[model samples]
Target: MKKNIKNKLNNLKASDNYRVRRAKDSGNSHIFRFKGNDYLSFASNDYLSLANDVRIVESAKKALDIHGYSVSSSALISGYSRSHMLLEEELSNFLGQEKTLLYSTGYQANLGVIKSLASRGSFIFADQLNHASLIDGSILSRANFKRYEHKDVKELESLLNKCPDSREKLIISDSLFSMDGDFAELKELEQSLKKYEAKLLIDEAHSLGVFGYQGRGLVFEYLLNKNENIFLTGTFGKSLGTFGAFFSGNSDIVDYVMQKSRGYIYSTSLPIHTIEATRASLKIIEEEDWRRDKLFSLIRYFKNCIKKSNLTVLESDSHIQALLIGSSADAIFFSDELMKRGIYLPAIRPPTVEEGKSRLRISLTVDHEEKDIDYLINILDMISQNLVQ
Candidate 1:
């Protein structure tokens, strides 16, 4: 037993990648108290900066008062609440879907969708750069999995042509890529799916409340809102700045998952307070369009600044901006130096990205001001000119 574990542990240590934990004080932005120094983070996925929003917090508190704490059992086992039902209804209306099914997390939602849909002989066509959750879910489905080049619908068409006529096909992808900030070509992909008569599953983890009319998502933004064979999975963790997740589709599909998906059936549901806060966050996204505008403004400014510094900015037209630093050591050093100057963004390294492509994944929020962008620009310029050395 000792010998069996020793080889695996030793391999991890030898890889220059021993994972560790650091405590963070989550109540503030630009003020993570770790190891006696405050660091401003760009690593968090809270894009709208609504995690600490006063109204959301108050709504959560009110829900706690009304609903109390523990959801002592699964939703099927008496854990379901009025707030959960309301949120599900609101999501269905917002997404223009016939129904929605809530889950404990985005990861679990992806798993449930794939495991339930992709049967033996079914084909799962995926984007090469899709999130790990989608990949894991497809593998777990016991289906014939095929991956195409990222955002290349032509390649996807070719793959679809090759599949045997005996099996059903499901194509899965991210609406907005998590790391690269690139977007899927929705219209083209839809055309390919039509040619093959395949079902589509889109994970809108990064795009919801960031694109489309009233931030409904990329699906609505692109006028693909009424596709009957399309399915969508989204999370409150990103733009909504809350917790939990949901999947939206035709009423039949949603009901089937509700009755059959093991991930949904086995797990306890999200707390009442979390559901209430997510509801409040969605309300804010609907009524306040200016936040989306402000985010785009900052994105444009940052891109212009990155260009002036002569740094390579990857081709991403979304809120995520990657400044390629090449080597992991250089990326790590650059992140550390920025922290020393009271600016913080982590170096995304191998496994998170392809080797030799480590980068600084700078994310913008509605709460970040023009001045913050200016400061980041100055620091990046200084680093490029070798001043940080």
Candidate 2:
């Protein structure tokens, strides 16, 4: 087994897809300190730059003085607390959903929801570029998994038409594609749902605290009201600058999943401090309109800079910007060259992205300024000038 593992590792290295982690000594923000050097970072998902906010930290500290650390058991057992219940309620009210349930991570939430809702004899239709967790959930459900071309609601409807009418049909998609940085055409997906009589599961992980009406999410932005057939799964780890995740829908579906989801029943609950911290983050997310304002400003500046530099950028509806570098080796070289110039951005490679589609996924946050973008564009322009195909 060890020899086989070694051989697989060698193959990954040979493919230029081996990944390495760099420990940042400082808290997450626009600048990350690593090995006694600081780099201007464009790699964090802290979109509103709240991860190290003093207000959130103080809230966590207060909760720690009372609840210590983790709850140590699942929500179904001794782990669920007033903190969890209150947070769930808050999220329910915020998202305009009838009910909500907390999970250990976004991955667990996706697994629990998809598997609980769709089982054997059901059909799961997903976007070709849906997140790995959503794909895994569909596979685990024992459902007939069908994938359509990315954002192709027409293809999705065609697949739905082929499924038996008596069998349940669930369509899974990410509201925002993290790697390619595009939106799932929710309006078109909704039309398909009505025509095919299928339920939709939209993962709003990347859009939760940065998009929609004051960050309610894309579904709200488009539908203006929750549809009975649409459910949402999201994480606090991204724009919220916190940990844990959640699933929300109409009361009946939420209750059914609560009873059947093994991931929710088997995993430990998030720490009380983390929950409290998320509450504080939520409050800030609602009140601090300036953060999103500043973030959009930086995004526009970055786009202008990229346009002027004559660089290729994948279409993005939100803060995530993908600079296409083509191949894994070339992407790595671009990332390394940026690191040498004190700009921290890592190459996004397969299987995070498809082969030959590797690129630098730049995450713009509230803390970044126009000057920072100027410096980055200058470095990228210089690198591209000398880069060999």
Candidate 3:
């Protein structure tokens, strides 16, 4: 088994698709340290720059003083605490949902929700570009699974039309495409769901704390949260600057998932300190409009800068920006050149993205200044020109 693993790794290295972890000595806001050198990072998902906020840290410490870290068991057993219930209530109110349930991570939330809701005789219509968790969940559900083209509502509707009305239909998609940095058309999707009497499950991992009023995410922004058929899931690790994830829906759905989700029922609850820190982050997300304002401003500025350059960037209204570099080797080369100049933008290759569509995944945070964006544009332009020559 060890020899076979080594051979597989060798094949990956030859294909220029092998991945390795880079240890960071320290990191704060938009900067990270590696090998004793600090670099401006465009690889983080900390969009609101709240990951290292003093208040959040202090709140976690306070929780630690009171709760002493580990819950030690799953929520169904002995791990569920008053603090967890309070956070769930707060999230429910904020998201305009009847109830909310916490999970260890975004991946677990997606897997649990899909598997719990879908089974034999059920049909899961998923977007082609949905996250791996969603894909895996659909496979594990043992349901009739079908994937439609990316963001093509018409194609989704056509597929739905072909399905039998007797079976349960669940439509799953990412509210924001993580790699492409584009939004799913929730309005059109909701219409299709209503027409077919299908249920909707959306993963808002990249949308929460970044889009919508009070950072409630794209569902609320599009008024889809009021739709009883809609179920929303989001992660705290991204914009919330903490850990864990949540699944929100009507009371019945929440209760059903609580009883049925194997992932939530079997795994230990998140530490109390992390939940308290997330609470602190949620408070800031609701009250601080200036953070969103600054982030959107930076996004606009970055897009404008890219427009003036020769780089081919995907259309995105969110914080994630993808600059296409065509091949895995070219994408890595571009990322390496930027790292040499004190910028840390990572190259995203298959199967994270489609083959021959490898690119640099640039994540912008509110902590980044206009000048930092300017520097990035210059570096990217220079690298692209040199590569062309």
Candidate 4:
């Protein structure tokens, strides 16, 4: 029976693709060691390098003294605490929203928001390239979920028009496309949705601390009406360097999510220490504007370096920069070659990216230096030339 199960597992693996996690013992940066080789990691989501900050560590330790390790239950049960409430208040004020609700992860936030809002007879218009969590939530919502082409306002408008006149409609999109790192046309989307009288939802999982004047993401970046019927979701796992997610909107939406969103109602709340750490991280993001500036400068620096290398790179103003290699085998080979050179960049292939457009996703942070960027450029230049040869 065990042999049969192993054969079934092997068959399942052969049917698609499988990926394994490599161990690392360090904080955020492009350079890390794994399997006894040092590799330049261009793949972490810690955009601001606040995850391992000393100040955050101190705050977390303080909270641990006050709140203990685990809450032992979901927030609705016995997990709600003063620390969680304080962070919610801070997040609400920071985002200019009426209220904010927290979840254990960004994926759960997306799932809770979609599954709770769009129900039977409701319509949900999602971007073609929305995150898998959003897609899963829409499917599980039992609503008439429609996907428009990515960033196409006209396509979204047309789909909204086709929905029954009496049906409630919600349009969902990522403010920053994670894989591509391009921003959504929020102004156009807002206008189009208003024409159809449908509400809009923006997931700022990649934009929370990385965009806008005050780092409020695209909502403020485009000057959208703050008190309008728009929903915004952000994650601490990325820029905030914490381990939870939050959704902000009107108070009623918060109440509804708290009461009805299964993902939130059932899941355990984030640790109190994490909440305190996240609050401190947000302060760092606001007080240390230089970090953001440094991040952008590094992005520009790296982009220019790649351009000087005469390599084709995706047009991205965000922290994520990808180099299209066009085949999984090619991408894997490039990543392996870079690893052998003591520079690590993991291969991103089909499922994460399209089969024909396999590319290297490079995540930049303030922790990386000018020399690190230069070394990466040199390595990529050599790899590109050899691949062409």
Winning model by TM-score? 3
Clashing pairs in 4: 30-41, 39-344, 40-344
Q: What do the candidate models score in CA lDDT, each in turn?
A: 0.86, 0.90, 0.93, 0.84
User: lDDT tens string, model 1, 14-88?
Assistant: 653444556664534334566666666666677777888899999999989988886877889988998899999
Candidate 3 residue pairs in backbone clash: none
Model 2 local distance difference test score: 0.90
User: Model 4 segments beyond 4 Å from truth?
Assistant: 1-16, 35-38, 225-227
lDDT of 2 by residue, 1-389 (tens): 99999999999999999999998888575888999999999999888999999999999999999988878787787998998899999898888898999998999999999999999999999999999999999999999999999988788888988888888999999999988778998998888988889999999999888887778888778873479899899999999999999999899999999999999888888999999999999988888888888988888888888888858788775788988888999999999999999999999999988999999998889988899989988999889888843
Best to worst by lDDT, what's the order?
A: 3, 2, 1, 4
| Predicted candidate 3 versus true structure: per-residue lDDT over 103-185, tens digit per residue | 99999999999999999989999999999999999999999999999999999999999998898999999999999999998
Candidates 3 and 4 compared: the better one by TM-score is 3
Error of 3 at 134 (Å): 1.0
Residue 43 miss distance in model 1 (angstroms) = 1.9
The alpha-carbon lDDT assigned to residue 72 of candidate 4 equals 86
Clashes of 1: 0
What lDDT score is found at residue 260 in candidate 4?
89
Candidate 2 regions off by >4 Å?
none
Candidate 2 TM-score, C-alpha based:
0.98
Which of 2 and 4 is the better model by lDDT? 2
Q: How accurate is candidate 3 locally (lDDT)?
A: 0.93
Residues 309-389 of candidate 4: C-alpha lDDT, one tens digit per residue: 868788999898888888777887888898888777787776777668888888998788878889888988888888788
